[model samples]
Target: MVYSEQQIMAWASSFFWPLLRISAMFIAIPVFSGRFVDNKILVGAALMVTFFTLPLLPEHRAIDVLSHEGIMTGLQQLLIGLSVGFVLQLVFSAIIFAGQGIAYSMGLGFASMMDPTTGVSVPVVSQFYLVLATLLFLTLGGHLVLIEMLIDSFNTLPIGDIGMERSDIWSIIAWSSRIFSAGLLMALPAIVSLLMVNIAFGVVTRAAPQLNIFAVGFPITLILGTLLMWVTLTSVLGNFTNLLAESYGVIGDFLRIRR
Candidate 1:
């Protein structure tokens, strides 16, 4: 079939723009961006998704892929995809913060390990929370929901120079404060319980200065912290669910997706 240069550029532009958005999303989203997932597999998956999503996307205006206008459009799509993923990433960061707080309270601050997902050193308590959060994320089908939202964004957000505005960026930055607020809420139980335990120990130390409170108090704090965590684990999962729902709402708002 003999196709004109305009027809050829049009076809390439349609594929190129959607691919940029999908690929950028895969590079930013949590599970897909982890070290366990190979780069080659991620690219292949992104390509496959882009190919399928192409049929669902709205028709694009023909623009030369090498032109300045094309470059700006691509950047807009990339930012939209990244912002969606980044908002969710903040939820996980909040979970990490909660874990760290609990760990410090339990006198386990020295117990650190490298997280395979992000390859960063974190307290063992934090790592434990991370594992549960990851499982909950998958069990709740969070990954699937994110992909669906990304697909929907093309219709709502479209490919153009118009994208996230200054207010939208500010909203995301404001939402990031949840890392501390939500984390504190999650860790509050452990923090308060441990503080009371420490207070009691302080009272005993004053009563018996020769008792060597360090030796006696350390083990008791560790045991109490473990028990407290076990008792509150269900509450932690509930908090995560609420946080995840909030994150989805933020993404929906940012992408202009209804519901």
Candidate 2:
């Protein structure tokens, strides 16, 4: 059974292109992207997914893997995968931002520790929210949905020079603002509640100058902030769900997948 050079290249291209996209996605997505997950595991998972996905992918035109065109095609695949993962990454970033805001409002801004996921220092409050969001993300099968979208993209976008368009890039940039807006929305209730508490402390300080706000108000503010967060925690999951849905919609638009 002699396989011609063309036939061999076609098989290689089939595996290589999809591997590039799937591997890139694994490197960018939230939970899997964390340092806790071993690189070897990621590679194995990417390979496994590519193996399964190859059958579902459309027939490929044999392009030499070492050719200039092949390089461009690989880049396009990488970009497509990264873009999809990046959109969801922003949603998690928003969750972190909201936690940071709430921590600062509660005067716990200084109470920060290193995040194992991103390897950066963040407030304990933010870390708390991050854990919850991660759990929710997994529980809701968000990872599965992302993989399904990526598979669908091969049909809609295909592996070629024609990848993400100018409009798609602009949409991602514009959607990046979600980190601030969505975060602000999540933190707003706690922020406003804390602000009012601070204002009341200011009034008390003004009416009674001898009273030490640092000694008296600090503990009270901390207690109140905790209570406020407990009360508002109920809505955090709801906010995340809405944001996740919006992100999926954005991804669908760019990937040309109908929701």
Candidate 3:
């Protein structure tokens, strides 16, 4: 049971760094990141993974855990974990964005529901999209892939204070625009069809001033929008697959750039 201070410090550092990184990721990424997931569960999972992974990790340099360098190193690990999670967050956001757009176009913006993940009232359409995407993501083994990538990051980036570079930051910033664009693209078909329906209503109102466009147009738009949403459902799976593939690729590139 006799152990020197050096041996204890080495053991602590090995467990400490990886735990910090893993916990930070669980705080930022999906399902596990949600408020529904308890803090104790997340910490326990981090601890289990850290123990399982410690043997594969590199030797730790003895440094005072309370020292300035140690603090900086912890921050760097946090940043690395957040960056990886942020990329995936963008993918889910795109689905939510598209859902909102479609809901608005279908005149269902007022149909709001509390989002379990965000704890905010969002259009029911958006909620549906989020649920569908979550199921699809799980079906595709996205969670497993994400975990694998998280583990691979240690090998690619190593456990150190080598935080993301300026270019890496810029790349993440630039890549974020894809969220809006991809979302718009997903909702485009529905938007366009709705737009045409509105135009037709406009022409009818103009040609026959006696017609109550408000009365007739509302029902027609709602009906058409619902139908269009069903038609667009098929495309959603394909788009989600592409977006997820791109998201994972971006993650890989992000890690490679750090190297």
Candidate 4:
């Protein structure tokens, strides 16, 4: 395989750009997207994977590794990667939101813990829920499927191809909002139950005029909400799993990159 300098340069160019795009996507998406993956290790790992897959990739026009278009290419890659990641982030955050609501209703709001992912204080219960959701995500192969979708993006929407259009960005914004709406629905069961408890407490206090509502209402809300959560957990998990899967599907659809 005697190759000229230009031929070698062209091969090198093709290799680096795809590698860069793949690395950017994985670096921004879930599981792989974490701060836990050190930069040195990530770069090394991505390089290895890129090289591993290089033999099988289809031909594309080689891109200049250092040029004005290359800078734009990297930025576009980063934007697409971030967009993909943010969808997953939004879905996971919805679980956190639901957890917060559940914690407040259960009187677990006072005790806070540092969330390892976000480095912020959250109700201990929310962290607990986040951990459980993380487990569920892994159990259901959410991370595996997500990473696969990312790789498929390179095929459906190749590297050095200018990334998302303006309309695509706006469409993504609309998709992101689904997380909040999904969270509200997931928490709705708990919220509605708590609201009823409050109304009951309000009515009893107003009619009797002798009850200490604050002291009594707190325990009542705490106990009843916890019981409701216990009863409704199966439904909650089912809904969450659906949301997680839907997020992957949505991201794929957005990129016009399917399995």
User: Which candidate leads in TM-score?
Assistant: 2
C-alpha RMSD of each candidate structure in angstroms? 1.1, 0.9, 1.8, 2.5
lDDT of 3 by residue, 1-259 (tens): 8999889998888889888888888788876777778889988887888788778776657666799888988887898788878888898889889999998987899999998887888899888988898899899999788777777777777766475677887888899998899999899999999989888888999999999998998888899888988999979767977998888888878676332
TM-score of 2: 0.98
lDDT tens readout by residue for model 1, 1-259: 8999998898998998888888888888887788889999999999999998888889968877678998888788888888887888899989999999999998999999998778899999999998999999999899889999999988888787587798999999999999999999999999999999999999999999999999999999999999999999999879988999999999999888878
For model 2, the superposed segments whose C-alpha errors exceed 4 Å read none
What is the clash count of model 2? 0
How big is the RMSD of model 3? 1.8
Q: Which ten residues in a row have the lowest lDDT in candidate 1?
A: 155-164
Give residue 21's lDDT in candidate 1 (0 to 100): 87
Per-prediction TM-score: 0.97, 0.98, 0.94, 0.87
Alpha-carbon lDDT, every model: 0.90, 0.92, 0.84, 0.77
Clashes of each: 0, 0, 0, 0
Model 2 whole-model lDDT (C-alpha atoms): 0.92
Clashing pairs in 2: none
